[model samples]
Target: MADTTQDYTPGSHPDLPPPSSEVGVIGWLRHNLFATPLDWALTILAVYLIYVLVVPALDWMLFSADWAGETRDDCSREGACWVFARVWSKVFIYGRYPVEELWRVNLTFIIQFVGLAALMIPGVPYKKWTGIFLLIPYPIIAFFLLYGGAFGLEPVETSLWGGLMVTLVIAEVGIVASLPIGIVLALGRRSKMPIIRAICVAFIELWRGVPLITVLFMASVMFPLFMPEGVNFDKLLRALIGVAMFSAAYMAEVVRGGLQAIPKGQYEAAQALGLSYPKVMTFIVLPQALKLVIPGIVNTFIGLFKDTTLVLIIGLFDLLGVVQLAATNPDWLGFAVEGYVVAAVGFWIFCFAMSRYSMYMERKLETGHKR
Candidate 1:
């Protein structure tokens, strides 16, 4: 009978073995790029194609490009007209806004940058308060600053706002305003009340069914017809509202998907402890749902940002709009490539930053992997 009971203790290990050489950087390149004859052939062909395309472009843009020029005449046909970029950089960034008032844009951007960075950093304190300020007082302050009628600042019409400033405002407002509205709409769509469900469903479907460009056109053109004859709204403001509403519809769908992913037990458990619907959602359900749908939310955000370029159609001079205008200027004629390249780079940087941040948050919030 001695030692009949099995020893149940599992042994613990002190160290993780280093990954084999076959899994290191060199090994990774070998496995992914050059593992077999066909892989090697494809890799070589790809690299050769890349070099053929990239080297000449690099040479033209960098080594042979005009670095200093006074006018289009100074630019050589053989290389990139970099001088155009240098001269019009400010115009690209600030649009046709009065150069003297550029500091206001700078100030707004700096405040937004610092505030958003602080909020995004994991360990920063007072985030809830910061968010409150952003949603509440921040918009009022920004509106006055950007469209000043009081505080001794001369009023600048929304028509004067353009370039990166216009782009950022449209995008940021859409993002901040859409999230909470989307959540409410998502919850309403799932509500037990028939009227609430129908309204939410109709709202979401109506917006989502239409193209955003149509919404913008309506905001720019038809929206005025609906308003009182004397009363008016800023064109930019109208565009912002249109963009936010359109984005919220898509976001509601994303949020609804996340809400549905939540387990029935979560709802039942929340109810068993005497939690109300709002309490159950705010404390237990929403956090998990939002966490699950971060990728979709970020995708919507990126699409929303890119969609801001369409503001050009409505006569707003966003970054791309300004670039198009600048490319046709007498002094910078035929430099559409230069202007387009700069705009493409700017857009890529912003979109790439957002995508990377989403990935970081996803990894940070990951709870368990499905087997």
Candidate 2:
């Protein structure tokens, strides 16, 4: 040892850290953005395109935008006239709901928010009971709170219901009403009985084949003719029913695909445990299948939510419709862009939230299904 052998321990050379370029932000960029020549080129091109296109757009929308104004006269032609949106904010949110009675609409929204938060957040007590209340009775309470034909509350016609309020009402009702119907249809489509399967197939296809606009048109127009004499169906109610049925058709297909993806062994295993058909599906099959198809189901819901805009065709002014209505006003003649931007952002927020929730569910329910 005193002779020229270096003192060293086997497998120990002061374990070196990875190069800094292979570690943090630099590593991520190298691995993802500049992994190959093609990626490098694409990244550079994307940066260039964003600078060329998005930079000016952002400049117009933010830096030069007129945020402080009470009327269209305050807008300078050089940038976005956000004043139009602000002026018509009432119509955009609560629609023609009486200014004096805006409290009802606001209260309904508060209740909905509270109910949803209590249900969704973890560690809240009595979720099962809360869900039962929300499912069975909350709709009735919300309806009366908005419609107001009882409890000494002044009645607001469905005709007065427009803008984001109506938009959310339609979408929420359609989503809630459609899910169970779709599940039943999905089950029926896969049923052993021939007649039941055929019926489910026919119903799903019939609704799926028709465009949503046509469905809304028929619901608001032709449906009245078929009703009995002296029987008046609320226009909003008709639209709700049409939307739910149409969405249910697409949802059934989604659910069916999920059900099919399930391994046959799972079903056979449940059966072997002496479970009945309904019991097996309720306990095991549906839970797994729904978890797998969360994305698809949420996609359908997003589509339905956007399609709620089409109710404007039936003379119901949704968020978009209200904006369009405001744009036509002589006082706000040339600010359609601002109004449209508001509506677009509103829709994107709701749709994005739903999409994120779907992803969360997917992650929460993740099993050994991924590669």
Candidate 3:
């Protein structure tokens, strides 16, 4: 009955050694990159290729690139003209928007950023109120501020809006509007009611079957013809509607995939607990379904964001459109590569940030071990 448990000493195990770079870095490299002579050779080859590609790209971007000098002549023929992208930054951001009225756009972005930050915080009190402000009142206020038909503010036409402002607006509005619309469509598609299910199926199929360009074209040309005489719609409004509808169709399919992934047992369990169909769906199925499909939803959003540039084909001057327009300027001749590179970099940053967020959300919500 005396102490039978052996006193264990630290570092007593002979099988395991204290961790070091060899077991960590070297071990990983050996297994992943240089386990065999062929792997080592391939790894060396890859390094050589990266260096070969990156050095020239870096030289073109920085070492030999023009950082200053107003005229195109100041730019080195051997490297990029970064100064062009710098000087046209405002044009990229605001498109054709009047410089004097840029305060309106700035204010709208400030409000939106602040509101979204507050909403994302789990500890925020009065979330319902915050949602009301962000969803309802904020849009109305932003609209008046942007359009400026009231309170002695000069009215700015939608045609005047361009650049990153229009791109972001189209993306944001399309994503926000599509989510609920998609949810409804998904639910309807899954419903027991024959009429509801059939209607949802047809609607989803019709929209999904058509390419987005066709939808945009229809919105720009055909929508006007369908409208009553003297009932005019803003071009931006038409594009926004088109983007939203096209996105909603894709989102509906993504959400339905998530919904379909939910187990039958889960539905049965919810129903057995005296829950109606709505309660079961809302409280049990949907939360899990949406969580499961966060990546899909984000991918859809990123695609929609990138596709906002397509509106330029219909006369809207989104960020890419502005760049194209700038290329035509006599003063800024022959700088298309600089403009396209900057635009591509801008897009890559936004899309990369979104992909990182999706990964973070997936990790944060993970409930089980991944194999």
Highest lDDT among the candidates is held by which one? Answer: 2
RMSD of 1: 7.9
Question: For each candidate, C-alpha RMSD in Å?
Answer: 7.9, 3.4, 5.9
Q: What is candidate 1's lDDT per residue for 67-180, written digit by digit as tens?
A: 897777788778888888888888888877787777877877887788888889999999998877877988888878888888987788878877888888899999998998
* Comparing 2 and 3 on lDDT, the stronger one: 2
- Residues 34-125 of candidate 2 have per-residue lDDT tens digits of 99999999999999999999998898889889988897778886889787788889999989989999999999889888888888777898
Candidate 2 regions with alpha-carbon error over 4 angstroms: 1-41, 369-371
lDDT by residue (tens digit), candidate 3, 11-104: 7845758467457888788789998899989999999998999989999888988898777777877899987888888999988788999999
Q: Locate the minimum summed-lDDT window of 10 residues in model 3.
A: 13-22
TM-score of 2: 0.90
Range of the 10 consecutive residues with the lowest summed lDDT in candidate 2: 1-10
How would you order the candidates by TM-score, starting with the best?
2, 1, 3
Q: Estimated TM-score per prediction?
A: 0.89, 0.90, 0.88
Residue 174 lDDT (model 3):
96
On lDDT, the stronger of 1 and 2 is 2
Model 3: pairs clashing at backbone N, Cα or C within 3 Å: none
